[model samples]
Target: MKKTAFTFLSVIVVMTMFLAACGNSTKPSNEGKQGSTGNVNQEAPKETEQPKQEEVKLRVFSTFGGTDAAREAFAGALDAFQKANPHIKIENDVMSANDDGFRTKVNTDMTSGNEPDLLFYFIGADANEMINAGKVVALDELLDADQEWKNGFAPAALNFARHTDGKIYSIPMTGFYEGLFVNKALFEQHGVELPTDWEKLKTAVKTFSEKGIIPLSGPFDQSHYLIEHFVLAAAGAEGQNKGLVDGIEPNWEKGLAAMKELYELGAFPQDAATIDLSMAGNYYSEGLAAMILEGSWAIGGWKDETKANTTVLPFPAIPGGAGTGKDVVGGFGTGFYMSTATYENAQKKDATVLLLKHLTSQDTIKAIATANGGTPAAQGVEPDGLPQAALDGFKMVGEAVSISMPIDSKVTPETFNTIRANIQPILTGEKTPAEGLGAAREIELANKK
Candidate 1:
């Protein structure tokens, strides 16, 4: 009996040792997962680490930096874009919108391979040149990729945006309209009717001049607004298009001669030969002038009282002229372009595109249009709170048989300058209309080479 008891005690001791070994192994395995929670707390950063993102910097160059209404509108829109896109930084270099040398500045930069990521400029000849040089990106694919954004643009605007290659490099923002901004108060004060036809216009000019008030305030030496109006009004759409291309139309001579006739009739201010756009606009705004042949861009600068009494109407028909009396000189004036480098750079491509979209978006463009008193490139832009003069200008364009682009825009810079320079002499009887236009045509032909 004693020997049996010893054997049972030995078995019990072995069983206890085996059970202890199993518990030790199981405890360590369970602690590895649960104790890891504690370890995770200690080394928390290691599990949540993320790759750093590089900030993208972009340079934007534009001509909307002056004290004009468009300046404030563009600045506000740009600020909004920056706020929405914090990761992308924009450095804007703004120049004067009226600076004729703006194109020269852009040309110098383009030739030196120093282009901004984005550029705001005219959409026609220069835009086509940039596209041809591969400086600007063709946005057809980008536009097609987003139909909602594309559809927001008017069909006419999209056609205007495209180049001969059927690819668009620019996105138009606002359209411009040219007309006679008449001060109805001044007309009533002079006992003259608002001119809607040639005979009434002549009568009004005679009455206003006799009263010692400037009949029409225009810049004779510097601006092409008058030339564009008179020439397009005389040539009509088909003839104007032909004149811009092949040669100066016969009607162009008539247009130039008509200016002289008006000058002889005392239609313009005595100091019109020396005045610039600002001076003319000031005269009209101060109620000292009967009318100013200007664009929609000038509406914002009109005095509050004058703007209330202002009305925009098409240039009166020139007697025996070929133009449809209703045709106006105006079109999509300014557009934004993206650099090819911006598109090729993987870093800036997406952000630059996003910025361009934002700048040309429906809301932003409509705001710009409202601020500038011009038409929006986007469709369905409500004319909320638009000045009567502005609405009148837009109405004139809508009812027009066809809108003619500015003659200066279609001509070479040198030829345009020649036209501007000789206008004073032509109106003063120093140069014949035929002589002036012939000289301009020679320059145009030479420029074609």
Candidate 2:
């Protein structure tokens, strides 16, 4: 165990160093479209009897692998796109998706001034840095110009594509909810019906506790995804709540109390912060816990790992909650992004538009999601006849289009480090949640300044 952990840690360190090295600014100039009116260097047509054709290929760098289920599902769609555009050849490369690792590689590529024609990267949640750095192209013109395709997507999904500047960057890949993963057999064994609110949940958990079963499991490894999901659940159940805290930014305060409350329940294993993210996905298989608060990706992992009688649902409504039991808290996952650099290069720029348009089609998205175990982004591809709770959760978010909060991602990256390390101790009584949150708030405020 120690050896395995050491190896993982070594890889993480290397990726961190690699990403940090990418920040040196020696960027390449944008090559504006060759035939477009936008560039100052637009060339006049030569007096030739026949129009000359321009040749270009789009290079796609992905964090997705060809063998990945998502990629498998998307392969046919991509083949169709290639058939449609003979001029655009796609070269797909899969890189690591560890947050820091992906960031480092992309950062290095951008700083080298040769950004990918398109990035299959996380868009909305992680776009703050990319948008601020002007790495992402503003797609407002492309989107607004396409009234037909623009109306094809649900508005809630499109809302995340907009930057604070009100310009669009990338369309969403797919949306998911952070919810409770249940071991139905365990609840049945304990004779504890699912609890509808947090207090009753505490009772149910305690009942399981007496039988020597851990009631919940989580991974707080770095970003505190487990804890953060609980916060999102509480926030969704609480009126899709956003409040103005004097010292905090837009998303800082909404779910703090709920996170603290869950920590107090002693739900997770000891030293959960030090555990690997993959650990919680195995809980039901190992019989460690009754449930988990996680996203749809768990569906893929669990099906591959175990055959336990398991299911998923939205977090039970918070006691005295203001929102429905099915209220969900997450945004559509990111989509492909065009590079401003590609748009500027006359030869390379037109290739960017062709590929970007093809990648956003309903055909491509549905195939990718079907293979990847997510509910698809296309309007007609929803999950059918699952638990009513799962269906309700999915529909609620579609209707409300709740603001997708990047609990940890929204704060500064430096602040991310501070809170990531401290979440477990603070949640489990070693430190008060208020104190820990205050420490995080301090770092966040400093970063903003």
Candidate 3:
């Protein structure tokens, strides 16, 4: 009986040793729990980790900076984009629209292989060079590939942005209208009638000048709006659209001559020759002047009181000219263009397109239009809280006989600059209207070559 007990105890001891060894083997080792850096962690191996997203940097050049009415709104959009895309960085390169150097800068950058990833500029002649050189991408395919995005834009807006080659290279954000913005309060105080025609305009100018008020708040140097309206008023839509290519239209001469006639009657500010568009706008905004020739974008920059009193009218037709007197200068003149470089770069292509989409999105278009008092390019989205002046301008557009794009869009930059350079000279009698148009014609011919 003692021998049997010893054998049983041995077997029990062996069984206990085997069970302990199995338990120890099943338990995880401290060495396996340690990472390569010898740090203790219970996480999975490095091979199972998610890869980091690649970083992308893009540069977008636009006129939505330096006191532009839409500057803040555009910056807000950029901020929102960055927030949504943490891995992408955007360089908001901008220049003021009023700065003539901005045009030179854009042209220089485009030709010097320093093109911005995206460019916001005029859709017509201003972009033709870049488009022809293939510096910018034709967005036709992109638009077709994304129906949701394509359908978001107004059909007319997209049609207006199409290039001469039957391809779309730009995406419009807003449309604009230029007109005679008259402060009704000033006219009422002076006992003058609204300048709806040439005779009434002359009477108002005479009365305003006699009362020591600037009749028109426009600079002779940066006389873009002045030139546009006068030319449209005299040349009408047909003659203006013909451009200087078919030789100088007689109505164009009449347009420039009318500017001189207005100048001699004390229609401009005394300091108009030295001032720029911004200062001229400020004069009207400050109530120092009764009227200003400006665009829809300028309404937002005026004082609230001035905005409240403002009303837009079609620039009156020049006497004995071809204008219908109801024709106005305006359209989808500018838009956003993506650079060919950015569109072809595989790493940046997607990000740049995304940024472009964000910028031209319906929400963003509405925001920009609201801030700038421009016609939104997105269908079914109207700008809210617009001043009376803006509303009046829209009404004027709606009732217009014809809406034409600005002359600057039809002519080359060099040719237009030549015309602008002659404004002060022509007004002061240093050059005749014929001489000014002749010089511009020469530039236009050379540009075509």
Give the best candidate by TM-score. Answer: 3
Model 3, 1-449: lDDT tens per residue?
Answer: 01133332332232233123233222121121212333347675899665776999999899997778999999999999888777889999999999988999998999999999989999999898988898998999989987777876766677678788889999999888899999999999878999999999999898899899999999887888998999989988888888888799999989999989988899999999899999999999999999999999998888999999999999999999999888878778899999998888999898888888888887788799999998777655666688888878877876677778888888998899899999999988999988998999999999999
> Taking the tens digit of each residue's C-alpha lDDT, what string does model 1 give over 1-449?
01123332332232233123233221111111211234445655766754545789998899876646678888887888778666678998888766667779898887788889999888765555677789988888998987777877766666666666778878888777899888998888767888998788888888988888888898887667888888877877667766544766888888888878888899888888777777878898899898889888788877899999999989976777887788787767678888888889999987787888888777787688878886677665553467888878766765676676777667777777888888988987889988888788888888677
Cα displacement (angstroms), candidate 1, residue 335, comes to: 0.8
Report how far off residue 331 is in candidate 3 (Å): 0.6
Question: Better model by lDDT, 2 or 3?
Answer: 3
lDDT against true structure, model 2: 0.57
Clash totals for all candidate models: 0, 8, 0
lDDT per residue for candidate 2 within 260-328, as digits (tens), equals 565566666565666655566566557677877666544544543232466665565554434345545
Candidate 3: lDDT over CA atoms? 0.84
Candidate number that wins on TM-score, 1 or 2: 1
TM-score for each predicted model, relative to the true structure: 0.86, 0.73, 0.89
Considering TM-score, which of the candidate structures 2 and 3 is the better prediction for this target?
A: 3
lDDT of 2 at 234: 50
lDDT score, candidate 2, position 165: 70
